[model samples]
Target: MADLEDPPVFLGFDFSSQQVKVAAIDGRLDVLHQSIVHFDSELPEFRTQGGVHLHGDGLRVTSPVLMWVKALDLLLDKMKTSEFDFSRVRALSGSGQQHGSVYWRRRASETLSQLDPDQSLHQLLQDSFSVSDSPVWMDSSSSQQCQDLEAAAGGAQRLADITGSRAYERFTGNQIAKLRQTRPEDFQDTERISLVSSFAASLFLGDYAAIDYSDGSGMNLLDISSRTWSEICLDAVAPHLGRLLGAPLPSTSVLGPVSSYFVRRYGFSAGCSVVAFTGDNPASLAGMRLQPGDVSVSLGTSDTVFLWPQQLRPALEGHIFCNPVEREEYMALLCFKNGSLTRERIRNQCAGGSWEVFSAALRDTPLGNNGNIGLYFDTMEITPAAVGLHRFDSDDTEVSSFSARVEVRALVEGQFMSRRVHAERLGYSMRTRVLATGGASSNKEILQVLSDVFNAPVFTIDVSSSACLGSAYRAAHGLVSESGVSFFDVVKNAPEPQLVATPHPAAQEVYPPMLRRYTRLEERVLQQRPT
Candidate 1:
């Protein structure tokens, strides 16, 4: 037990797409401190736009491993300048952008096992990685590798049944296969591979950290049911692939105490425990403290919808991962590439770059947007695998365009309706409640459309950084998990999710027919695209 005078604090970190963020929470579960390090602005030497380098081919994307390391150094120094009491930290955990992967050189583990307190991590581990530029979730260059893996596992649906998701180009398994086949010399020189989540854990543990099952399930390499690496999937990727990726542990497992380097340099307590990290989406689910029948929709730069499903429904469209906090359960996710930026584009074009104007347009248009629907993807979308702007009228006929006000309502409605359609395909029902988080969740006008589309009440939480806060909650829960206290019990005292929007009574009448028409229009859009 910690001293009563100074309550123990739990730390949560999020290595997101654009930045690395940290949040500290006291024993009462209230946020005590928060900080961030932006990659593009803070570390311009890496030359990253949106914290990633887009290849000339437009499908390949990567981030500098050293830039991530350097960002940590900057973040901790910022905390130190803020006079944060690192000595009071009891346990720490984090979340990483899903599907990003890191490769270690032959002697990198040896270097990690013996880090020096005097030298910064960036200096000591400058040459430790076999591949300096790690492939991230935005990457989509491994289509051939995806097809090959699916065929090896006896087709798409069969593989989905085993791994909780069908082979996706961004999944780590396909990324690894692409690297091994395309860069054989680099592959031969590599000793181990770590998901971005475990790679960050390794930095704190002073050695390699076991990949948690929740993050491993995103790789298309782990068997979701058995919680172990699949032999067939292993054989399909590379020889002796199981050994490269160490045995995965539960998300709550404590790897060990923080490395002595932190104790000597940053004043972290020697007894501070380092908990296994997980993917950002899973961490958000934990942070929201979702109930059994709740679905979470995160409206960020790239919108994502996830749910704690009663049963696993394997599909090619979305993803299912091992639940971060519950061993016997699973969570499903759907990603939309065009979320905030797409909304911003429409707002600029239709409303002169004012969100208030955008909201007014939504209010002016009637429900269903008078049967106008639009699908806008500024970039390639993952869910339906389509790109570009598409519009349709009430008769299900493709249209050149719509009025600006109609376009605004159509865009918001189309986004939520697609979420409902894809979610239903994965066994989610309309009756489940919604917990909306992320930057766009504060927009009641947008959430009203979401509520109407799903015909469910929309709830909002107060936390701004769900992924980071979720990691802190997990850090606290990990301390009590061995004694059998449920995660819900641990976070029960946290603020209640506030009711933000409820469906209009007439929503039940207007949406059913509109949804049917939208589905047909979506099929037409897919047919027009080049596969």
Candidate 2:
């Protein structure tokens, strides 16, 4: 038990796209401390760009499993230096970049159950990974595998009916099947497979952690309706997968105490409970403490827009995932690959790398950019299944260039406008609020565009990392939630979500036709298959 002298705190970790971050929130749900381990710059040893290694001509992305382990060690050490009282931390939960996997070798259980406090985690477990490189969500190399799985499950629509998503190349069903086919030897050697979230939780529990329900929904293995593994879909992907995956638990289930590794090395109490971790997007939904109709727009390395829907309505364009906290509830999400990186590109090319200049330039252009709409996909995009940068004038004719200011405006406007179009396609409507989060949400000018395009009030929380904070809140909730308090009631008093930007009433009239323009242009782009 922790010292009753000081109030308890909860720790939340986000194993995100670019970094591993940890934040602590006090009993009242106020953020007390935060720390980060950036892969590219801080941990030069990993040599990762955006926390992953890209390969296979841009179709495959992976991160070293041990690199994440070492990052965990380094982040805790940094937190220790900040004088965060681990002994007072009653519970901890985490969120991981969605869909990336971690492979454990046959000796992994033995390796994980016993760790040397004298040796860093990376040093002791160097060879514990059966696959040195785990396939991540950005990998598109699984098209053939997706096809095979679709065939097994009957077809794409049938699979969607069962699994809550279509046969997307990035979904874990295809990723695992590809592993089974391409690296048969490695697959045979693997003892367990974990989504990156549970993998992080496993390190703390001194055992393999069960996948959380919300994170498992992303794997295309879970029947979101029934809340169990889809036997038909599982058999279609790999052999004996359920054994490797173990049983997925609720996001808020407390597994056990903190590992002795932390109890001995740091001053953490052995009573510190480790709760099941979940997908980053789900955590964001929790962090924002979404109400009935609010849309969550996360602007991270990938821009994801989600809404907590009343019931399951799986569609082909986006995905419907199980809600993290509640049973019999679901979430609808649409991801756009070109997010912050694309913003950085236009900031460099148009405004010489100055966000202030970029904001000024963007503000200079009118809404709808004088009837000019553009698409700039730095890489292949998720929605609309398109790639390449395209610009068009008022007449809808493709143009070579616009003024730098117009380009900046188009990039910001086009991204949010597309989000609106596809969101409606999924049968979602803009309700009272659009809750914007992630790194780019700090930009008022950019958020203004989001507000205008969505034609709803835009809001941002004071906390920068929504996923991590959500996990922290979950940690607090998991520990005392048996008292029968609702999740919203738990977070209601922490801080009011601020109304940051409001849509101009004129924007309602201006954006509808331009959204139509963005749709036509996207159609043209998607029609031309990769040559």
Candidate 3:
């Protein structure tokens, strides 16, 4: 390990929906310490499952904002136990779960500014939240609100052309509207609204933080082309929405020095700078240091395929968000709700709950699984908005079920095929090298299939959390940082991602027929759904 006198390290935090994660890196771009604190497992008193409180048949998903605050305390404590040096940190940046909103109670900023160094953060600010439970990215409780907002903007396509998305229930615009419609009292009491990213930054800066343009884009309130809140969407969502949100900023912009709380309580230097935090996906993009032709496939709870787009071409199908670090660039994103969890369903039901068994099942099945394709969505899916697990034979006839081995192959093939379709629909070419991240990135069976479906090489980074590493890297590339270089300049010399699996030669012949069949089946399933 390098001596404590080594060049000052930069700090990065990832305040995700489920946990608080941290990573520190030295000036030479080497990792110093990295760790995480899960909200449910570590803080059992909160009684959260996957960091969410679900209701109305899991359509409504919320997480206690205070839990995120406490997670910071626990995460910092863990870092201290590992002999982490807060004094070595010269700059800090972070990532948060995109689109989740935190409603601050009146005088919340004053409460934050006066946080007692003697008391824990969560304990001091228990009453600072106007809405204790925050509506998160998983929530779908605001369908009517979404429709109303869409209609108010003239139509779905018009809204999509303006804000980079048609109205989405999980988006902050609709969630804010839902809160105002259902809980007018709480809405009235709320002094300021913060996206989850800005809320985490507020805790560190001891002040209200400006929302980052990248995270703001996810809210369906940002005019993505201009990187500002759309007045049309704002008027539809609420009164005084613009005043509450304030202005958006570049992700790499430093807000100010670290709060006195950390300086006194954690031995951090008061001079350490705090940079604005952004969404986890954009952080991943920065961490990965994506090239123009590179595609990112994140296999998390929600599977996503993204690419750095040259132009802001918004479509009704997916979304376009401002690039987190490169303020002028935009990113195209296509998310599929049925990702790892759906894979788990097939793994449990068919592979006897063993990934080993699942791998064995994949090995047993042929490349095309004998012309069998499966559409597995354990819940309502976002990509095509299709529900149910439907199976089809090569002839396009619906089948009740397939063999266990076939089921495993079909699940892997189907998920990637959907990603391929949606990415193409959004004007993304699928032939580039795919940088895969998140939990499932390690699965060779999955990567091999991903490579086959996209007809590209798949690679995984060496670091554990791309978001955290990305955030840490951002800390070094920010305005307050010592590096004084572009993010690309800093990361270009970093370790390259490990090549996982490549598409088999036979896959070229196999996937084309299967993709065509999957396309037809997707159309059928979408048509069969009640409109």
Candidate 4:
């Protein structure tokens, strides 16, 4: 460690769905301080549930733009009260929940560039947004817009080929299309569109910040291959959209110095560089130090599987984003909407609502659950677009149910099997190492099924705030990225992930047949379901 008298530090911020968090780290990757401002609890004036408002339709979700601003103001104040040395920060980077957007009102730049150190950000910028309630990632009310964009791009596959994804309701471009069609006046008043990632960066830069490519890939308006906004897509969203979005930057770009506002109010160093902020997913990839051949499985409320791919394989399902750490490469992500909750439903029904009993059931069952398979989707699933519980036995014969013990094993196996199939569908073959994160990764039993399904060793790290940590790591890497220092080298000594589970000896023989059967069964279910 360097001299304690104002030793150099790096900062990372995560403007997430529910909270605004910051992590300060030393050069050696040791965390010096962590602080958070939760929007729902601390900023109750917003009256938000889990940081967003759920409309009556249950699909139109939004958060107050000023709420995010106020949370940031509150978070910085908390950090200041703790006597954190902000002046020691060498550089900073951040992330935000992907796909969400912020619409800056006309003349918003004037307010941003002229921020007064004496006034809080929230107080002065109350009217900065064109849309006070910004549509967030949870919003799925843009299906008409999604269909329109897909139709404009030729087809779903054609759109995916260009933008790294089909037109998703939650993507920024579709959201913008909806805004223009539904709220034309607000769309007209919008001067600039910033992905939540870049919006947070703008607060620090005191100017409009360019959306980074990694986060921009989620927008359905960017050409993944060229790393530029597609002119075809721009015309599809709105008129003269290019002027509003400006240019996209690489995730590693060092934008500029911290704003004078921060320097004066928060005592951040005048020389502190603000690196390009990216999406939370990309930041997590950087934080986890995900290598070319490594796969990351986050077992949270919604399970997500992502891996750095050797080649680009854009498909209708899943997504491909420009890699944050490797500019020349890309990352593939497959999200399962029915993850932890679906598993919990099975645990409660079959294991008496006890995780201990759930684990025992899993341990008691053999690999492949003796050729029984199931798909339990408590809600709509993203990958297959299918819901409801389906079960089958060794002969691929449809079965209404199975024993409680079998149901437990089938739930775990089915979830991982679906992940493997979808990941491979995205052109990612099984890699040797699987890095597991999130709340459920702590369960060794669940991880064993994951390991077996992927036929790889599963590893876990002590990551509480990966997005923030990843941004901090990005800040360090950005400081020397121009000199050709790799991200791996910058965080090589931070900490080693612990190997939690390895594939069983019979996994190779057991899973292939079971997976094949599951795939066919899934197809049958999809075919029978009404559109």
Q: Of the candidates shown, which would achieve the greatest TM-score relative to the real structure?
A: 4
lDDT of 3 by residue, 100-147 (tens): 999999998899898899999988999999899999999999999989
| Cα lDDT of model 2 by residue, 120-235, tens digit | 88888899999988888888899998888888888888888888888888888789889988999998999999999999999999899999889998998898778789999889
Residue 198 alpha-carbon offset, candidate 2, angstroms: 0.8
Question: Tens digits of per-residue lDDT for model 1 on 1-531?
Answer: 336488899999999999999999998898999999999999999999999999999899999999999999999999989999899999999999999999999999889888898999999899999999999999999999999999999999989989989998999999999999999999999988999999999999989999999999999999998999999899999999988899999998889999998888899999999999999889988888876667888898988888887767889888889989987788888888889999999999999999999999988899998888898877889878889889888877778989999999999999999988988877686476898888899898999999999999999886578899999999999988889989998898888999999999999999999888888888888898986
Q: What range of 10 consecutive residues in model 3 has the weakest lDDT sum?
A: 479-488
Candidate with best lDDT: 4
RMSD of each: 2.6, 3.5, 3.4, 1.9
Q: What TM-score goes with each of the models?
A: 0.92, 0.86, 0.88, 0.97
Segments in model 3 whose C-alpha atoms lie over 4 Å from true places? 1-5, 55-59, 81-83, 114-116, 300-302, 340-373, 389-410, 438-440, 443-445, 480-484, 505-514
Model 2 stretches astray by more than 4 angstroms: 40-50, 54-58, 114-119, 298-302, 339-379, 388-413, 438-446, 506-531
What lDDT does each candidate get?
0.91, 0.86, 0.86, 0.92
- Pairs in steric clash, model 2: none
State the lDDT at 313 in candidate 4.
90
Give candidate 1's TM-score.
Answer: 0.92
lDDT of 4 by residue, 1-531 (tens): 123486679999999999999999998899999999999899999999999999998999999999999999999999999998888999999999999999999999999999999999998899899999989999999999999999999999999999999998999999999999999999999999999999999999999999999999999999999999998899999999999999999999999999999999999888999999999999988888888878899898999998987678999899999999878789999999998888888888999999999999999999988888898888888998998889888887879999999999999999999988888878777476999988889899999999998899999987788899999999999989999999999999889999999999899888888888888888898998897
